[model samples]
Target: MTKSAIRIALCVALVAAAAIVPAQAASGGAVAARSRSVILKHIAFHPRTAHIRVGGTVTWRWRDGSIVHNVVGSGFRSPTKAMGTYTLRFRARGTYNYVCTIHPGMTGKVIVG
Candidate 1:
């Protein structure tokens, strides 16, 4: 095939593939509505960045390995604990940033879509 024809075929294939991908809706969309877990240990949150669909939940489990820590973020905060679990539900489509109030440089984010 000629180069120009090959390029046209590739572009058509790319557009076709893109059209097959699912699309996310806005406002009261059908999110996967699942849960994710993160391990809080070693002075950090394991898997610092989590991705979930809108209306999903994230659970932060405290592994008994250090001082007190908590998950603090916009309109959400878990109690400081040495050993326990905290869960937050993401109801909106946005990014939620959190950190441990007692520990510096301890930060994480949850991306909701």
Candidate 2:
């Protein structure tokens, strides 16, 4: 094939492949459809980011061996606790970023769609 023709073919293939992939996946991010749980350990949230449908709930479990932490996100907040669990139900489709108020650099996010 001619150079021009090869370039056109490659562009077409790229467009087609992008159409078949989710925008998040195309951007090199992992999204879980039924993600309902997260773990708080070593002053960090396991699975730092999660994805779920609108109105889905995500449960945060504490397992840092007596280390206190809290999940503070946009429009939602959890009381500080060293053990047990906290649950938050997302109502809108958007990205929710959170952090540990006491621990610097501890962060997480949730994508609701």
Candidate 3:
């Protein structure tokens, strides 16, 4: 075969490989995992309760009209902060509880499966 013909064949093979590659396979490992957010308003977590899968993350945002609130974990003293946000990743299959230190009556829970 001619040298130019060999080069052209190689180029065509590369083009075919590129065209057959799945887009997802190229960046699948670097893609960011999906996450969810919950709002804290009216001195309480808007949903008050929720369920999520392991490896998922939940972010708590202070709503504009919300009263001061916090997300306190067990054995952890002093709630995080009011008008502030906190994120927790559910890495295990279990239930976790949190409450507002500013207001003892406000509470929330997360069930991970």
Candidate 4:
């Protein structure tokens, strides 16, 4: 096949593959489930703490209206940009402590049992 035809065929294959792949699987399927959500308000985590089974997911929703908040764990830090929501999946059975970067005093914990 000619070079141009080969490129066209490759592009078509890529597009087809992309269309067939599920969005979640394409990203990463390790984290699955809508475990729970903790809203950020009054510069504190609404629930303060939560418990979930291992392999569960936790989503933090920033609800201070216009203020920016971040979910920072031991070594993981969510994007600093204003995010309406952020998610973290626990794969191990342990306690995880997280705090809001915008307000250090605002803290929360997650217990994965």
lDDT of 1 by residue, 73-111 (tens): 989899998998998888898988999999899999999
Give the root-mean-square deviation of each candidate in angstroms. 11.1, 10.6, 6.0, 8.1
Which candidate number has the best TM-score? 1
State how far residue 68 of model 2 sits from its true place (Å): 0.2
lDDT of 3 at 107: 86
In candidate 2, stretches whose alpha carbon ends up further than 4 angstroms from where it belongs are 1-35
lDDT (10s digit) by residue, model 4, range 11-68: 9999998876777566755444438889888778879988877888888887787778
Candidate 3: 10-residue stretch with minimal lDDT: 26-35
Top-down lDDT ranking? 2, 1, 4, 3
Off by over 4 Å in 4: 1-34
Question: Ten residues in a row with the worst lDDT in model 4?
Answer: 25-34
Which lDDT value does model 2 have at 63?
Answer: 96
Tens digits of lDDT, candidate 3, 1-113: 99999999999999988876766566654234446777887777867776777777878898846466667876433345556677777777788888887777888887777
The per-residue C-alpha lDDT of model 1 at residue 19 equals 67
Q: Give the Cα error of residue 36 in candidate 2, in Å.
A: 1.4
Candidate 4: C-alpha RMSD after superposition: 8.1
Any idea how many clashes model 3 has? 0
Task: Provide the TM-score for each candidate, comma-separated.
Answer: 0.71, 0.69, 0.60, 0.66
